[model samples]
Target: MTSGDTTSGEGLLESLEHMGAAERAEHDAEVSAAVAPGREIAVGQGETLLAVDALTVRFGGLTALDDVTFDVRRGEILGLIGPNGAGKTTCFNIMTGVYRPTSGDIRLEGRSLARMKRYRIIQAGVARTFQNIRLFGAMTALENVVVGTDARHRTSIPGALLRLPRHRREEREAVEKAMALLEFVGIAHRAADPATALPYGDQRRLEIARALATEPKLLCLDEPAAGFSAAEKDALSELILKIRDDGYTVALVEHDMRVVLGVTDRIVVLDFGRKIADGLPDEVRRDPAVVAAYLGGTVEDAEDQEP
Candidate 1:
């Protein structure tokens, strides 16, 4: 079926989607039976979900990321923070296959992603939202989320063309899943609204909902709290934690120190294309190098500021 015609079986799809979520939680529980199930692990404390080792990316004469190495453990929020030109975005580009690294390796669940195509990278269970919001502005919020779910549909082209029952069912399932995801992210009330018409905070939530629709194992959010008011940032923080609680890992590159410190389990600091610190939020906040590179003053000064 055409993308527009995929919402016919919402009831069946909603039920199926709930079943899937329950099943996923069960699977995760079984895997964690030896440990505590459903408890979010601390960064660096579990099996690696995404790893980069000695990764170097260069653009002609400038080295964007030099010898960057770190790992994102499954079921934790890993915050990547840096000053401008610290090569944070470049590192993301390399991991997401937007730019091939000049040297070194990027591994997702132990498989090297060197030189993989962008589409292949998505299929490999990595999805990202841009620093600047990217959305299908002309489409409704539901439609935008559907674009993300489109990749996971099992219907064949010929069957869709002929309007076969199975294809219709799959198409309907995709739309319902998209709606459910939007609801989960607190944007379902705006589902019928055009993306461009929503407020800025809603737009950010929509972007996240879309990315999650891809069913990615690792979700990378670039500057998700940018431009938000303090109250809005607080809500966004809750949304992020809820996502993590739902059983997906997050890798965030954010500028808001409050949001980063409030949401992340561990923080990775980058400066001049090199990793300067990686530790718990409190430890990273106190790290001299991290403070120098970005905080740019004494932790005492930071502590003295009004919250």
Candidate 2:
């Protein structure tokens, strides 16, 4: 056959066997864009507080996260949402140093988080709340918050034994700071109450107050609105924004669509451990793939369930 004839024959066979030119070209473009070295997403109005690139985590043969990537801007609330097993919690785990990634990297303020211990991560201006409330039930709310500020305090056996002037001054400052954090979260009234004595909603607030006591630059909350009523959710949303307005960046993993859409400055949607969308709330809400993956096939499904 002539060269043109042979090329034409091969092209025809390839078209019949796989994606057409348009489909293949579009796929190639996506791959190239993903791997290309350029600005990923502009983090809020300033520098990025946290960035996760090609983050992958595995549990035995089950891949919990496959190249998940996103950014949380400084002084903004970034919502991370997905289905039950979509690795939302796992992402929080990796960020807080609860679990190291099998691959990829996590950075805080452009610094590597690899091999950092949980306490070290906290000391590096990262603090987190659990999906399940993890608080000291036996301790008063004030004491619980005081515990959060312990990392920043300079107390030692010698100081405790001798009651040094410096120790007293440090203790007083810590107590004042803890009280301020509790007041910031609007839970100062319950400061003297045992944590378990507070109502469920208040417990959630207490958890946030305690996390804030760490003086974190970036706060990660796992499902903060999980068991809240509508009013409670609204309050939680306002509190989250208030937290951000107070100059702390927040990364929240939540299931309540209303809370997520209402409070987040931006959002990253994951499905089956892979990112399907990342944009402003309205933009992500309208993304076709995000709708299908998160709402199970239709935008209508997502809307109908929106609170």
Candidate 3:
């Protein structure tokens, strides 16, 4: 090989070594940060990880959500479901700070999300997926996930332009973390492929991996199972539970009964901009109001059935 090739190879090895060191440091920082007072708002000791209290949203007389209230307990999956235009997405949007509430408030670990910007909400430990697939189609799966790791970027603009030591360190650390996230979401096999080249299901899993790259305390999924088949939905349910088990509080907005019933610890139902029910999956499933709203039939004395 040419001397130039040899030099490039050495540089690549150095970069990998630097990233390995940074990853170790990052792991330690994560442990310390989790227990650091003030840095962490202590969502663990609290009864709720997310609280949407009487949130109302309107767009020029179009009331999308009205006085919706619910709680997502720590390390649990809370399903938010309703029929078309039932304000499920609206509630999800407001909760993630995509849209401001017309009235009332939202809190994550007792920290009010009132009037917070979307990026600020993410930094405060909330991340969400879109109703539509939003992967960077032209980018590799790993690169797309690396975008989410920008939530932890600390390099100054000048440092990045100049390729300063700090900037190099941060970028390497981000790549390391992004690859780890891809493995966590079961997409490591496609890590080097263009995002658009993956199957639809893999794309969905990639989106979740991207969301996890931000290191969120609460992961909000908006209609994640919108287009999946029966088997895919079943797998998605297992993945959701695994996410919850991995120390995340998941809030799901899905229409698939397989996922809503099989995955969530609690389910909240909304109709006509109003919350009609909030309870365990079985209770919400059997509620006459929920059945009436979803099935469009007159209610009979429905008995509580287990999920």
User: Which number leads on lDDT?
Assistant: 1
Candidate-wise lDDT, in order: 0.81, 0.78, 0.77
**Model 2: runs farther than 4 Å from truth?**
1-44, 300-307
Q: What does candidate 1's lDDT look like per residue over 56-170, in tens digits?
A: 9889999888899999989989999999999988888888988998999999999888889987888888999998899978778877887887667777878878888987666
Backbone clashes in model 1, listed as residue pairs: 1-160
Ranking by TM-score: 1, 3, 2
- On a 0 to 100 scale, what is the lDDT of residue 140 in model 2? 77
Kindly give the stretch of ten consecutive residues in candidate 2 with the minimal lDDT sum: 1-10
lDDT tens per residue, model 3, 1-307:
1111122323433454555565667664653333121223334633687888988899998999988888888767888888899999888788788788889999988999879999999999899999899987977787777788777778767777777898766666656666667777787778778899999999999999888888888889988988898888888888887777666778898877766888888888989989999898877877889988874554443343223
Candidate structures ordered by lDDT, highest first: 1, 2, 3
Using all chains and alpha carbons, the TM-scores for the candidates as numbered come to 0.86, 0.82, 0.84
lDDT (tens digit, per residue) of candidate 2 on 17-53 = 3656775565545433321212232334456888999
Off by over 4 Å in 3: 1-46, 295-307
